[model samples]
Target: MSSNPASTPPPPNRTSGDRDATQPQETAEREINPERDHRCESRRGGTVIIEGGTVVTVDDSGTEFGEGHVVVEGDRIVAVGPGSAPAQQGPVRRIDASGCLVTPGLINTHHHLYQWATRGYAADATLFGWLTELYPVWAGIDEEITHAAASAGLARMALSGCTTAADHHYVFPRGGGDVFGAVVAAAERIGVRLHAVRGSMDRGRSHGGLPPDSVVEDLDAALAGTQEAIDRFHDPNPGAQVRVAVGPCSPFSVSTDLMRQAAELARRNGVRLHTHLAETTDEEEQCRAEYGRTPVEYADDLGWLGPDVWLAHTIHLSEEGIARLGETGTGAAHCPTSNGRLGAGIAPVRPLLDAGAPVGLGVDGVASNEAGGLGEEMHQALLTARARYGPEALSVRDALRLATRGGARCLGRDDELGSLEHGKLADIAVWRLGGIDHTGIADPVAALVLGRLPKLERLLRGGSVVVDDGRLMPVSEAELTHELDRASARIRTREVSA
Candidate 1:
């Protein structure tokens, strides 16, 4: 969208089947300096050893080490075991993690990063009312606003232990000036993996949808835009920093043709599909009234349920819907705080998990949830499950799994991410548990989930420090705050003028 090379998407190296062929070439070894600023350092081929912490692997075996060590070589985990790492050959930067808890970096399965500029609006509105109040304001967003909002949102996510985030941005107003590219650039600037869903909405209020007509694209344009996004930015390589997915907003705001065609396009390009599904009772009622079928049933008819598809919210599903999702191996992204904030009913999380569906946690959008932190989602998810179902509905470990391995499955990245196993990408989080909030907790994992969200001692994405000593390394938070403030003010002014 932009002629600037820095903003342009990288050409895809290989097809999905040839992921192994795109392995990063080794870089020349350099002296390891622990005290140097990590933001300015070259990350490739660097070795980092983290010892003297409780390592929760979240692997298939559910491995946990009371006092463990993790060795990172380049961008992959070389070894993970109890106690200190063995002898290393190169200059390695060792982090003494005596009072920390090491775990797989949290993965956010669903979000609308652009909404960061539109928070604190429609604070007490229902799902439909909120859309009614905010769609016009969202229509005022341009590339600058979107970029600022996405940067601030991703910065919050990184500081809170999220390494990979899926951002579903569907609102593309006329002359928005490359808002989607802005999101991708923000992810790059923030140094986190992004599943950028090029979302579209073809059903406007005129077509019995919730959003305004100004924000909805025609069916042809929507499909063309999605295709262009895939051609421009979709990366199929292993350990990809950015991947494109097809999303057509929600059923209530999308035409049936767009829904069917988006699914087909995703499959044809070997990419994934994402969308808001059964998020509220209003959505269910609308689907039933329009198609004489429940939301889940309607989706199945459109071929929207599969392993490559992950739906957001999923709060209004019935038993049969849950069974269908599991039978089809579909994934669900549970946004507990957002649901509670909007008075959307609690999702049937335990039932969905028991039915064999892959369940992950989502921060949704800050406009709805306000906090916009991935780590807090784990805590909210655990509390919501126990409050809705029973005390045994979910455990602290289960909550961690939902944020890590389960999220990896939802994104179809289980083989490459979501765990601290050998050969896996070194996306890890170290939480400082020595603080007052976590000092008395007997179990580090419990303190992480059941207690307060611990401060991140360090967050590494692909062996690069994203956060160190509870501070984001790549960019200044104050700069992001100022950018966000200006962006929000501009959007507000435009909305008022319009």
Candidate 2:
């Protein structure tokens, strides 16, 4: 595979290791302004100019600009270069990015947003054990609670600098309302780009699946619902806020027939496919015992390996499996924190990248990870790679790339969402590195990945600010917190009674 070119040149006559002296040194607070209606069609994403920062463009060319500017006209970035951007012909909202590290907004390749209310339930369990302990609790979720959970989780990711996220929600109880619709509403309310995967588990214990009978769906019903979701919500337009995908829960939790049908449906509708795969040794053993083939082989047999498909975890792959994934152009979503939390072995991220497979970062579900921030996942990915493959296996920029471009590739949206470049959507994040926590840091980019995550001062999706001054814009943080707390209490009350 070819390496990305150095798009932005370093300081003139400076050595490679020299600190970029032109980086801003102080952060000035901005006064609160009245909330603007970001959803206005007339706005069409109004013009914005972000100037005076070190821009890290995780583009095909690894661009880094010391003292640069980005000009956003409407929803797309029009220019990026050193010094001030050329003035637009009309009115523009100017953002003072002084003392900030500007980059494309982080992308999350996999998540179970509805699990937000069930965090910490299986704190000491492995992958299978954790799912077993929490499946019953999740079976009680209704539409209202699911919306609350989705809103809370999406808001957390937005505040942490994520602009686009793919959520895999597989648990569906009878009369539980439209779980997919709930998350879609939540994403819209928060103004973050969403890739909603219509996930299903059609095989219960009687059918040898991991989930109980209560939460599983019929195969035909699952396929129909998936197609309906695609027809109803999947948007193919560039810079769209909501798109849909098809996801079967996992090898252990769904049937081979369901997997094939989900893949077929996704292809039929021109959407992507996603699932959990090879996350644990137990899963590998289950695939071997049930199908007489490894998970990758089994998936290949079912026509499930390709560019349009991305699997979560992927911690237990063999060399052959890795090669097949790369050859087939399949994607992998590496959830470092959740794997560590469940005692799952580290994923072969370096090997996956080296093999040319599309690899990205995922926080997984809140129940397994207990946290949903991409910044935390970036830190964990760095530490885990070092522990398993030596200190130099993963660089700070590499981890950040996984969280940004790698994730966009996994979701098949790299064309517009991953990087801060001309003709790309204006999904950007401005993180303040001038705080005391970031003191003495020479390289702001390295500090963002290796040091404690500094404050995320501003976040924009399509040139509209979703988080400003570290506060969520569309919904009230206090209200979201209270709603999630109430939903959690409701679930606990039902669990205690059951």
Q: Rate the local accuracy (lDDT) of all candidates.
A: 0.88, 0.84
Which is the leading candidate under lDDT? 1
lDDT of 1: 0.88
lDDT of 1 at 230: 93
TM-score of 2: 0.93
lDDT of 2 by residue, 120-223 (tens): 88789988888888888888998999999999999999988899999998888888898889999999998899999999998898998778899999999999
Each prediction's total of clashing residue pairs, residues at least 3 apart in sequence or on different chains, is: 0, 0
Give all candidate RMSDs, comma-separated: 9.7, 4.4
**Model 1's TM-score against the true structure:** 0.93
Error of 1 at 266 (Å): 0.6
> Residue 399: error of model 2 in Å?
0.8
Cα lDDT tens digits, model 1, 212-236, are 9999999999999999999989899
Off by over 4 Å in 2: 1-44
